[model samples]
Target chain A: MSPELARFLQDCEQDFQQALPALCQPPGSDCPAVPGGLAEAGAYSLGNGGKRIRPVLCHAAAAALGAADRTRSAAPAHALELIHTYSLIHDDLPAMDDDDLRRGQPSLHRAYDEATAILVGDGLQARAFEVIAGSDVLDAAQKVAMIGVLARASGMQGMVGGQYIDIHATGTDMDLAALQAMHQLKTGALIRAALALGGIAAGASEAQLRALDDYGRHIGLAFQVVDDILDVDGDPSALGKTGGKDAAANKPTYVKLLGLDGARQEAQQLLQAALTALETFGASADRLRELARYIVERDR
Target chain B: MSPELARFLQDCEQDFQQALPALCQPPGSDCPAVPGGLAEAGAYSLGNGGKRIRPVLCHAAAAALGAADRTRSAAPAHALELIHTYSLIHDDLPAMDDDDLRRGQPSLHRAYDEATAILVGDGLQARAFEVIAGSDVLDAAQKVAMIGVLARASGMQGMVGGQYIDIHATGTDMDLAALQAMHQLKTGALIRAALALGGIAAGASEAQLRALDDYGRHIGLAFQVVDDILDVDGDPSALGKTGGKDAAANKPTYVKLLGLDGARQEAQQLLQAALTALETFGASADRLRELARYIVERDR
Candidate 1:
């Protein structure tokens, strides 16, 4: 990884950490005390040290679009992370993936109670849209556009729909087409929204937005493909969660259908396609390009 | 009920029912098939027969503000219902309220499964914001403003936070202030948002909006106080769900805090206050006034 890309990610992490606690809290002086300590539980899951890939991608996309202030991307960046964290919290419930661990710590449900986990997840999702709608850095049009993108990506037709397909497909045979379709919605939609949100925040032209969408689609799938690969071989300690659970659960995956070498080749081709999509932006898109490479190459 | 208010509510219910099925489905032709039938599960809960109180409040508020076309309020009205339905679904989870029934039918988790219930709730919340953000009826500013109101009202500090407090306060002692505060958030916030959303849709002036908010707060508390009163003596058949569950669960309630007759008197007082709040609007707020009285007097 380039030092510049690493530094950019580091900065995003710092900014995100600073902004996160407030996101979980109710805004304004009239905030009622949540005697249940909901904010703490929300912060616990949100503050867990994930890679912050979505936020980094958002910031990079804005910078790539030549936004005068990359901080304009902060609202969407944080919103994406909140949405991602909420999905993780719900996914870890006993009725969902049933995982008891996440991000090297007890899952929100395991750490807190199941009820608190559920409310925290619900609160986080609401907070995501609230933050975007309330962002001072964004105009009304921009806020509406970003909210549209984020909502569609995270809604029934997007992440939640994908999850619906995945949970049902467990222990069932699924073709590569089926696998791709599920991942596209479950994981790809939000990833695509991240870039689109960043572009919207930066006031990118419609054409630029389309180009970012293309780049996002390719890398989104590539990210999932690489995730399948890592699940098969990545160290559990490094991954910070159980690995190979997919295979154990008999869920279909790119690695299972395409073979390890084939999945690797697919990811490489996707990386190439993602770079091609960014060609129109020239040097301004360097961060996006590096981030795409990092997405596929990173172990965790 | 006045014929005018009844007809207005009927129209709102019809509009909401017609728009609801589509909300659960993905928009656009490229939608992937969700084999888990998530859309159906979402539609089931949404389609269930509820009082449509929030949407009615919204439409009434809009009408009171003299919107030329009541349909202009559809997006926010539907969004409010979606948010309300989502909360009910989550609140019924085994980890939360653990009820097996809602609206005279099996609760979402009971009807489908826990995972699907959680996902549908999550999806509904996302779709609420999505519909508002993507509404053609509302301008960008209106959409942004409505999103802000809805998101804040339904968020951590609002409904979810209130639920957090209610769940924790179960089987414990809570004073009148604590009970009011909890009810204000859990139920009052959304009720207030419903009115605010309607007011915004109608382009209400600041003072008019404040009047609607004040009206909402009084009736919002009245609604809950009556709920506690009904829970103590209302028929399960009329209520369409188990009754007396609050006392059975030892959850804090107005009845417990204020006594039955006291709670009924409190509802009457709140109803009067709510009516006073709308005095400035005169006959224009007749629907709202009737609704407030209905809220306090209704058997359900």
Candidate 2:
């Protein structure tokens, strides 16, 4: 990996970790230090280490729009990661995936009781929008627009809607088109929202927002495709999660339908499509281009 | 009931029911109608008959502020009710209260599976914020502020925090102070937000907002006190829910600390305090004063 790219990711991770706890804590000093188990449960799920991909994407989109100050993007970046973390917590519930593990550790429901885990996910979801609503950096209009985008993506029409389709589709044969549509809502919508939020925060134009969204859709699907491939072939320790559980659960995947070679070829094509969406921008878009390749190539 | 107040409440209920379904459905025409079980579960829990007091309170607060158009407050009023419904659904989960009935029907988790109920609660929550963020009537700044208020009230420091305390406090004795604190967060926060949101929609002055909040806190406490009184003496069918369940579960209540007569006396005192908070306003606040009395006097 290039040093500059690696440094950029590291910085994003640091900012995400630092800003997240403050979001969950109460605003006034007189309030109790942590508010007990609900706060603890939220913090535990968020603090578990994972790839800070969404926040990095948000920062990258803002940088591409020529936003000079990284701090300006911090709230949206953290908010995206919070939303991502909350989804992971809910998706791993016993009633949902019934998974016992995530990020190479016991999942939130496993670490805490199912009730605590549920509240944690709900609280985190609320906190995500709260962060954006209370943001000092963005103007009111920008914050409102970002709120609309993020909520739609995370709510029914986006991630939650996708999840509803997915759980029902499990153990059933689905064509590529149905699978793609499901992923677009469940996984793709948030990825697209992350980019749009960054662009919105940076004051990007309507055309620029459209371009970022186009770039996001391709990478979003590619990300899920690579995830399927890793479940079959990647090392569990490196991946930081139990591998091959998707197939064991009889869930349909790109790897299952397309085979290894076809899935790899599809990933490359999607990566190219993503990079093409960023072509109008100059050197400022180099990070986004690199991220597209990374989505398909990351072993974990 | 006074004829004027009765008419006002009827109008608020109509607006709430009409606007709520539109909030759950997707925006674009292309998306599938109703989005299947998750959406169904959300609609089912939300559609069940209730008093619609929160939305009525919202409209009352707005009307008091001299807002000429009732239509302008519809979105915020409906959004507040959605948040209230979502909380009730989650609070009745098997892992939480383990209740079997709500609004005279099987509770959400009983009517649907536990998983569906969980998702329904989560989805409705996201929809609540989406309604505010997407409201065309309010300006972007107003929307942002409303979002912040609702999110904070529904989040860990508010409803969820109260639930956490209530669950832990069950089967244990509690003093009046602890009981008040729990009820304030659990029930009072959202009630307070409802009035504040209405005032905000009407562009109320800071002092007016403070007055509404003070009134909300008093009436919120009074509502719970009256609830405790009814649990012991009221008929279950009339209440549209299982009454006396709080005592059955060994849950803390004002009646548990104060005697039944004392609890009733406290309710009356709280009603006076609520009415006193609106002294600065003239007859415009008559609905609010009557609502406060009804909270203490209602049989069910």
Candidate 3:
């Protein structure tokens, strides 16, 4: 990664770190009415070390759309990070992915207890909306629109519902199409929303927003395909987490149906499509294109 | 409960039953692209039996605000119901409250799997917003406001946050103040939002909303007192579900702070306050006032 890209991610990480405590608590939670530890479980996962990819995509798109001053887009980007963290929290719960490890530590539910994990995920999801709506920068209409964007992606028509399908078919051998649909939901929905939120934050034009949406869609899938590839070929030490979890659980992956090389080829193809969508932006999209390339190329 | 209140409860239950399928699946989920078991787990909870108190509260408030037709408030009322159910689903998970039984039958997680319970709760939360946001009856602003109400009530600073305090403090004696704060998040927040969502759905005036908010706050705490009283003295057979679980778990309760008789008396006082709030509504508030009474007065 270039220093510029590293710097952008670092900036987002700092903003997310600062804004996170606000997102877990209910709005007006700063009042003494709420006791200490109200946000402890929520903090566990949000504080867990994970790359801020989705939030980075959001900030990058906002900056590309002439919100050149990164400071202006900080709040929405904070909300986006909360959404991403919430999804990971829920995904790692015993009922969902059942992973004992996330970012190389115990999953939220395991780290605390089951109820805490559930509430943490629930709290974070609600907090994400609260921050967006409570934000003074956006007008009511824009906040409402952003909430609409988020709700659709997080709800039944999106990630959560997608998770339901994945669990129901657990142990059932699914074909490639079933697998893709599941990944689109379990991974892609929020990625698409990240781009959508960025455009809304930057006040991008419809044409620019459309292009970013397409870009998000392709890379989102490619991101998952790369995850599948990593599970098969990447070194466990570099991944910083268990790499063979999917196959061990018999959760279907691209390689399960199409073979390891085939999945890598698919990721490459999707990355190319993501880059193609940014062709309209020319030099302005260099960062996004590079990010997409890194998403497909990363080992962990 | 009065005959009229009984009828209203039955009507609301029927409405939930009727709309259950749509609430379960993602809109356009039949696109056959996604893989979630939205229907099966949804049926596990929706097809089972439970009191529809939350939705009824929503409808009653909407009706009190003069949206007489159930169709007009179906979205918010149903959204409230789904969120309530989502809490139940998550609360029943193995890592949370871990109740093996609910509504006189197996809990959703126990009946299915932990993953199913998690996804079911996630799906319901998502579905609640989908129902409200996708509604044609309420304007976009109304939808956003309703989402905020639901999110705040159910999130960390609300129900889930309360659960965290409850679980974290398990096996230790809690002060009266700590117990009350826990219940405010666990039980009070949702009840408050139940009233608020109904009012928002009906586009209630500021004064009416303030009145309802007060009524909601008083009654919500009162309802918890009644629950704790039941945990101490009620008969499980009559209650139709387990009542001794709180005591067995050594969780804090109003009965623990105030004696059983004192808790009952407090409930009665809160009932009067709720009734006073409804004094201006004349006959339209009859059902709502009765619900406040029933929420406290019922043996369960």
Candidate 4:
């Protein structure tokens, strides 16, 4: 992990914290067309939450490749954030995850009607494309490729598929392989896509994009393994939301399939594989290397 | 319609009908990793039924504008079809309109499950972008703009927003103006967008695009008005499904808001307005003019 890279990511975090509002909040915060109380309903949750890791991954990937075209990466980055946040909204819906809290605040569906939550998710998903497709970056080929990447990652083959699988798994018995497959689609694919899009915008060679995708896949799976373990052991207060909901719901988890200790070992193996892929890039991957470690570590 | 234009659309319809199985019956349709069946499910209403009028409109828009760029419009045309089909799926959902049949076949959700229908809608929406963004026919900027147009028309400020208002209006005493506003967003916006995308792909001037959009908006509203009128007087067998459901649900409609006779008058007026917008386009809009008349006069 490079100190400069870590500091750069921190700065991006600060910048993202600032840029997200205009990208997300209604064209005007007070616009009545957005529905009464939804402004607060939307703003309260999206305004001050999330790890912002997806955007960070985009920035780091572009920066590492010496790509200076901010325009190319801007929309993709925003698209990533939008997709991630929108997923949170839907996952929190009563018919979905039904979690009452997110980032230590009342979830959007909880603070607002179930309809509003569904609508917000719909809006955010559309806006994600508007940001990327509307951005002045990349050639037609790259832009088209970018949309394909994001769409597939977020669509049936990826996040939505994962959610669909998880939704169907409620109170069902599942083994470790099935649980891993579920998380791979739900969480891992989109995260991998974030890195892939950065490479796409940067004009990385197919081989390089493939390598980064491999890295993203490993790290994304590792990230979820850590999440599952944290559910069994980490403090909920620090997580800013309830943990153990998976267990309470009889939802399967890596820790449930594997013992608590076994889950940690598996996460380490994924983190190692992720690091191995980054080794192909040597010093160019210093940030990604750190990102992998960050996934398996930290209290969040 | 110009015989040439009609032939072209008819050709596309023939091609799509043949490929429909490949498109609808994904290879891993039975994969449990996906929450819903991405493959064709019960009733197969979407691919086999409907006029496929929206896709025809997209192709017509591109062809009439002299695109010479057949490849570029493929993604956008397919995207338009997906969005149109997804709207039908959601509109027929139990939580929405609760229609059991569409185009003489069982609705997607009713034939499946509520959650499957929701997931299908989400998948279609996601896949639409994948097709558009991945298309090689347009530049990044063009693709981006097209995406923005689709998003605005489909998301909260557009189709979904209009849906919320419509659902909210159920059993409520709403006026004609309010009803018009709702339908404009729900139905007309997407039609306008489809024309705009087609024109944009052909490098249409802002004025040309605007005129096409204006024509689309007018005819779209007219189409809905005629639909409501048909519900009142249409033969159930010809309708190919249940009629009078909207009235049975006590939902607002053009006929409900305006008198039944008035709805017909409005449809005629709107059709003329649509044709009038084409006066600026010379001979290129001959097919569009014919289509507007068809929209107002169609029985199903």
Candidate 5:
């Protein structure tokens, strides 16, 4: 990883951590704090260390559009991470994936109670949009656009729909097309939304937005394909979560549909596709290009 | 009920039902339908025959603001009901209320699975904001404002916070002030948001929005107080839900904190306060007044 990209991610992580607590506060309230453990539980899950990939993608996309001030992307960046964190929390529920660990630590449901985990996830999802709606950096139109994109990506037709399909498809013979469609909604939509949000925040042109979206679509699928590969072969310690659970659960994956070598080839092709989409941009898109490679090549 | 109020509510219900299924579709997609039963489960819980109180309150508040076109309030109205329906679905989960019934039918988790229920609730909440964000009737500023209001009300400091308190307060003695604060968030916040949303949709003045909020707060309290009373005295068949569950679970309630007569008297006082808050408005607020009365005086 380049020092510049690492520094950018580190800065995003620090800024997001600082801004998140205040985001959990209810809007237009004079109260000094949220009532009880609700906020704490929310912070616990949201602050759980993860790759912060979505925020990086958002910031990189904005930079790709020649946005000088990174702060303009803050609202959408934070919102994307919050949505991502919330999905992880919900997906870890006993009724869902039934995972006991996340990010190398006890999952929210295991650390707290199941109800707390559920409510905190719900609260975080609301706070994600609330952050964008109350953003001072973005104009009203931009805020509206970002909210529409994020909500659609996070909602039924996107993340939730993907989960629904995944749960039903478990233990069933899901074809490659069906598997790709599920991942497209499950993980791909949010990744695409992250890029779109950054572009919207940066006031990208119509063509630029389409290019970012095209780049996002390839990387989004590539991210999931790599994830499936990692589950089959990556070290759990480096991954910060259990690997091989996907196969254990009998859920279909790229690694299962395609041979391991085929999955790796698919990832490389997607990385190239993602890079090709960014050819229209100059040096400003270098970070986006690098991030695409990282997404495909990261061991974790 | 007054003829005008009944007719208005019926119209809101009909319009909301027709608009809801389409709202579940992924934005900007050519897909003719949602991938699976996800939309079906969302429709089932959302169409569960609740009173449509939030949507009616929204439309009524818009009318009270002298907005002739009720269609202006449609986005917020639909958003309010979607949020309300999502909350009910989440509240019925096994880790939460553990209820098998809602609006006289099987709860989402009971009718479907827990994973489906959780995902549907999450989807509905996202779709609520999407409706407002994607509204043709509202401008960008109005959409941003409405999203902020609805998200805050449905989020940590509001409904989710209230549920957290309720879960923690169970089997423990809670005082009047503590109970009121809890109910204020759990139920009051969303009710208040309904009116505020309607007023915002109609481009209400700041003072008028405050008045609607004042009215909402009073009636919001009144709604809960009456609910507590009904749990003790009303028929389950009329309520369309199991009554006495609060007492059965040893959860705190107005009836438990204040005796049944005190709770009844409290409801009446709140109803009066709600009516008083609308004194600045003329006959345009008649529906609001009638609704306030119905909230406190209804048998079910």
Candidate 6:
């Protein structure tokens, strides 16, 4: 990555790390914390620390859009991360993917009980929108639009729907189209929202917003494709999750359908397409372009 | 109930029945229904007829505020009902209350699998905010504010947190203060939001809004107190679910702390408090007044 891109990613990550704890607390002054396991469960999962790719993408989009008050974009960025973390918590439930490990530790359900995990996910999801709606940075309209976009992406039509399809399709033979469709909703929608939220926060023109969405869609797919590839070839320690579970569970994946080399080629093509979508923004989109390359290349 | 209040409730119920189906479908034309059991699970619980108390409360508040556009309050009312339904679905999960029935029908997790029930609850919660944020009737600021209020009420300082406390306090002795705190968060928050959302929808003044909130709080506590009394004395058929489950689960409740007659006396006192809060509104709040009485008097 370029030095500038690297520095920008670091800054966004730091901002998220600092802002997230306070944001996840109960809104009222009377309540210091959520009454029981809620705060601990939420804090555990959220603090586990992934790459914060979603938030970085949001901040990158803000920069790319020439948003004057870039710090204001933090609200949407925080909201996206909260949504992502909550999805992970739910996905790791015994009734769902039943994963034991995440980010080098036990998944939320395993770390806590299934009930606490469930409430934590629900709390996080609620907090996501609450934070965005309450943000002073964005105007009311932008916040409303952001809420609609995020909710639609995270709800039945997006991540949750995709997860439903995924869980049902396990151990079944699935075609590429089916796999792509699931990934598009499950992961792609939030990623696309990350950029769209940034653009919305910045008051980007409709056309510019569309281009950012296009760029986001391409990279979103690429990120998932790479994830499938990594699952087959990744080191468990580095990945901070158990690898080969996909194959063991007989889940359909890009590597399984397209083969490793073919999947790599697909990711490369998506990387190019993502870049192409960002062409109109010229130098302003440099960080986004770098981030696209990073999505396909990241090991964790 | 007065004739006017009865008619208003019937209209809200009819409107809800008509609107909920379309509301559950995917927002965009690009996607059809969620692949499989997702839609069915959500529909099963949401379609099952509850008293629609939250929606009625919202509508009554709107009417009390003299909001000329009664139709405008539909979005928030619907949103509140969705949140309430989703909470019931989650609370019925095997790890939680482990209920087999809800509103005289099979509980969501019992009717479907646990996984589907979990996803359905998540979907409904997400859809609530989406519906509000996307509503064209309210301006953006109102939408944002409504989302914030609903999210905070439904989330970690509110319903979810209260559930956490209740579940943990099961089979344990607790005093009146702890019991009230739990009930206030578990049930009162959403009830409060229902009235608050309605008031906000009508562009109520700060004093009017605070009065609505006060009325809502008194009735919210009354509703729970009556519920505990019902659990001890209600007919299963009349209540539409088994009674005595709260005692059976060893859950903390008003009856456990106050005894049957004492709980009833508390409900009556709360009803009076609720009525007192609306005194200044005079006949404009007649429906709300009737509703407050109904809350304490209702057999179901």
Fraction of true inter-chain Cα contacts (below 8 Å) kept per model?
Answer: 0.82, 0.52, 0.55, 0.52, 0.80, 0.76
Q: lDDT of all predictions, in order shown?
A: 0.90, 0.85, 0.77, 0.75, 0.89, 0.88
List the candidate 2 regions with Cα displacement exceeding 4 Å: A29-34, B29-34
Overall local distance difference test of candidate 1: 0.90
* lDDT tens readout by residue for model 5, A100-175: 9998889989999999999999999988998999888789999999999898888888888898899888999988
Give the per-residue Cα lDDT of candidate 6 at A159.
88
Give the range of the ten consecutive residues with the poorest summed lDDT in model 2 chain A: A26-35
The worst-scoring run of ten residues by lDDT in candidate 6 chain B lies at: B27-36
lDDT (10s digit) by residue, model 3, range A118-189: 677777776777677667676656666677777777766677767777776778989888787887777788
In model 2, the Cα lDDT at residue A268 comes to 93
**Candidate 1's TM-score:** 0.98
Local lDDT at B114 for model 6: 83
| DockQ preference between candidates 1 and 4, better one | 1
**What is the fnat score of candidate 4?**
0.52
Give the 10-residue window scoring lowest on summed lDDT in candidate 3 chain A: A26-35
What is candidate 3's lDDT per residue for B1-300, written digit by digit as tens?
888888888877777787875566555632333233556777668757466767788888988988877876788888777778888888777777778888788888778778777777776776676677667777867777787778777776677777777778888999888787888888888888889888988888889988988888888888889878887799898776787778788877888778888888888898899888877786777788889878887876
**Candidate 5, residues B1-300: lDDT per residue as tens digits?**
888878877887788777875666654654324666998888787666588888889999999999896888988988888888888889999999899988789999999899999999899999999889988978999999999989888888888899899988899999999999999899999999999999998889999999999999999999999989999899999998888999999999999988999998899899889999999999999999999988887999
Every candidate's DockQ is 0.75, 0.61, 0.48, 0.42, 0.74, 0.74
Per-candidate total of colliding backbone pairs: 0, 0, 8, 4, 0, 0
Best by DockQ: 1
Report the lDDT of model 5 for residue A95.
96
What tier of docking accuracy does candidate 2 attain? medium
Instruction: Tell me candidate 4's TM-score on chain B.
Output: 0.90
Error of 4 at A133 (Å): 1.5
Q: Write model 6 residue lDDT over B63-82, tens digit each, in one string.
A: 88997656779999999999
lDDT of 1 at A187: 96
Model 4 Cα lDDT, one tens digit per residue, B1-300: 457657776787775566442443333552223343654641254565577767667766776687663565767777777777777876776556778888877778667766666666676778788767756667766777788788778876677777777776788887877777887887877888889888878788888887888889898889889889989878899889778878898988888878888898999999889988888776666767777777788888
Expressed as tens digits, the lDDT of each residue in A1-300 for candidate 6 is 778878877777677766776665755675435874678778788878798888888888988998654677888999999999999998889888888988889998788888888888888999999999888768998899999999998998888898889888999999999899999988998999999999988889999999999999999999999999999998888898889989999999999999999999999999999999988997888889989999999887
Better of 3 and 5 by TM-score: 5
